[model samples]
Target: MKSLKFLIILPALFLSNLFAQATILNTIAADPESGIYLTAADYKNNQLHLAGNLSTNNKLRLNDFLGSRTLTISHKGQNHEFSKDSIYGYRDKAGNDYRLYKSYSTPYKILENGKIVIYEIKQPGHKQNGFKPLVCYYFSEGADGEIYLLSLDNLKKSFKDQPAFDSIDANFQTDYDLIKYDNYHHMFRINRVLAKL
Candidate 1:
């Protein structure tokens, strides 16, 4: 009886402690190179769980560790949230329930200057030649609010050729007020009182 009780209580106990929302006062980083905080389930299962947004050197960068999922997007006055851990995607007003959009799978950096830099990690399966694109997503509150898709392969090789881009990844330096899509990033700022559960 005690053993069964322990098993039943274990999950509840673990989840009970986390009843509160993640009140991370940390500045958000696109992805924390420092590392992401893992839950016990994620740690034990060796699963990549989403660690909210990351904070690097006082800058706010969006972060989602479980590949790319669970980030909420306000699309056309409707709250489009990712329920399952799938590639960050969305459909039109009336479309499929799930699918892959042309979004970079890594964390996105929201610069202060309205530059959204998305980092796409090249796994073993997908590799365009020797270089992977740092898919840049540019957005702002003003004229540059739409998502601008720029590729590192295109930006650097504009005056050069794709063959010369024989690198593994691209390193991007971004800031909060200097972020590309911060105008949109601010859309995520939660300032209210509620229960997470």
Candidate 2:
């Protein structure tokens, strides 16, 4: 009678464990809609296991605020605190992804993702009337690479080892045109140059 009871309980325990594992894996997509990424790998893999919704109300908004050393995230029915210095970045509720590149705590909106990732960030301009904020562009060789200014001269100087970039200027009229996204190809023009390299 004891042996039969143990056999019956073993299968139930196995099935329970399997279900729990499946839930954990699926939680990335089953969330409250926004999350903090612990690493670049986590962001690249779309793994949002720490699933939570962040409040960016008032002056704490990312676009307006520079950034603080710590970030508090509400997750799993509790408030969890994470250091911006320790984590990669997060995705906003609107589905825009931001990257906390290196020591620059201010998040840079990731505009394009590929072998080379392009980022855009706005800097406050003159507070005078009719002055629009300056829009800046940045790029990184990869998810783990250091971010660099997105300009033809900058790209040429940074990738001195890559000879293929020498012909980059021949393809575009100006640096601005070089950075433009090619809607048909669904990638940045600079990305197309790097792809051939």
Clashes counted in candidate 1 amount to 22
How well is each residue in 94-153 modelled by candidate 1, as lDDT tens digits? 211122233535433432221222222223433664555434343322212333334443
Give candidate 2 regions above 4 Å deviation. 1-32, 52-67, 127-129
How much lDDT does candidate 1 score?
A: 0.32
Per-model lDDT: 0.32, 0.74
In terms of lDDT, the poorest run of 10 residues in model 2 is 55-64
Whole-structure CA lDDT of model 2: 0.74
- Cα error, residue 182 of model 1, in Å, equals 19
Off by over 4 Å in 1: 1-107, 114-126, 131-133, 142-144, 150-197
